[model samples]
Target: MAMLNQVSSQDVETLYFNHHGWLLGWLRRKLDNSFDAADLAHDTFVRVLRKRELEALREPRAYLCAIARDLAVSHWRRQALEQAWLETLATLPEPIVPSLEQRALILETLEQIALILDALPMRVRQIFLLSQIDGLTYPQIAAQLGVSINVVQKAMVRALMQCYKVLYRGG
Candidate 1:
């Protein structure tokens, strides 16, 4: 995809003039924060403009909503991940905890992991959490989810590959 700055000025202006208000209102309703809604509305347009086929769009609002919904899901995932990270931090012994800068870097890494998790299918994601977060063995996870051991192992491999790509490949 093209960068936001690469989008043509006239095209962006036209799209903003035609859809800005409606999209902002829609995001506001979904986000419940005027600032965040406004920011996401701008980002939605940025993503839309960066697409290669904007001129061919038959229904712009529908497309805009599709992009906005994705952004909303990402926003919520970050929020949930941050909350969980903070809770985990609270449980750590303060003397052994990392410094503030280290904590920030660790949180950024966790955010990437969470995004990878988001891309996974529901069953694969559940299996990953059971194995990683809940510390279950592969056989235990397979039995709990009513799948064969082979299936659980396959899901775990898929999840690990996704995480590896995000962590090492800048995906």
Candidate 2:
């Protein structure tokens, strides 16, 4: 279908000219911050450009809105995660608190892990988190979740394989 076909640079240029203002305003209303709204609007267009498929888009505004919505959700999720991390840091003694650079590195790593966890299947993710984050054994997880040990083991394997693919295999 033409909708799935590659879009040309000129088509993207036309799209930007046609809808940029509307998107910016829509983002502003959703984000309540002009700067972030502007940034996300630009990012939404960039994402669309990367997809490179818009020639047969029946509803460009709807398509843009969907992309922008996803971006906004991610933006909010990141902000919430940062706030939670900062709160955790605040609970630490000053001497034990990490340096700014170390905190940045830690936060980045945490975000990556969070993304991987988010991508995992629900049951697999629960098992993986129980084992890794809560320090539970497979048997313990199985007991807690009312599942078989074999089930827990298999879920753990799937979760680990997914993480390996995302981190090491760069999938």
- Which pairs of residues clash in candidate 2, taking residues 3 or more apart in a chain or in different chains? none
Which predicted model would earn the best TM-score? 2
Tens digits of per-residue lDDT for model 2, 1-171 = 554667788878988999999999999999999999999999988998787455687888998999999899888878888999999999999899999999899888887888888898899999999999999988899999999999999999999999999999986
What C-alpha lDDT does candidate 1 achieve relative to the native structure?
A: 0.86
Best by lDDT: 2
The residue ranges of model 1 lying beyond 4 angstroms of the native Cα positions read 1-8, 87-98
In lDDT terms, how accurate is model 2? 0.90
TM-score of 1: 0.82
Residue 10 miss distance in model 2 (angstroms): 1.2
Give the clashing pairs for model 1.
Answer: none
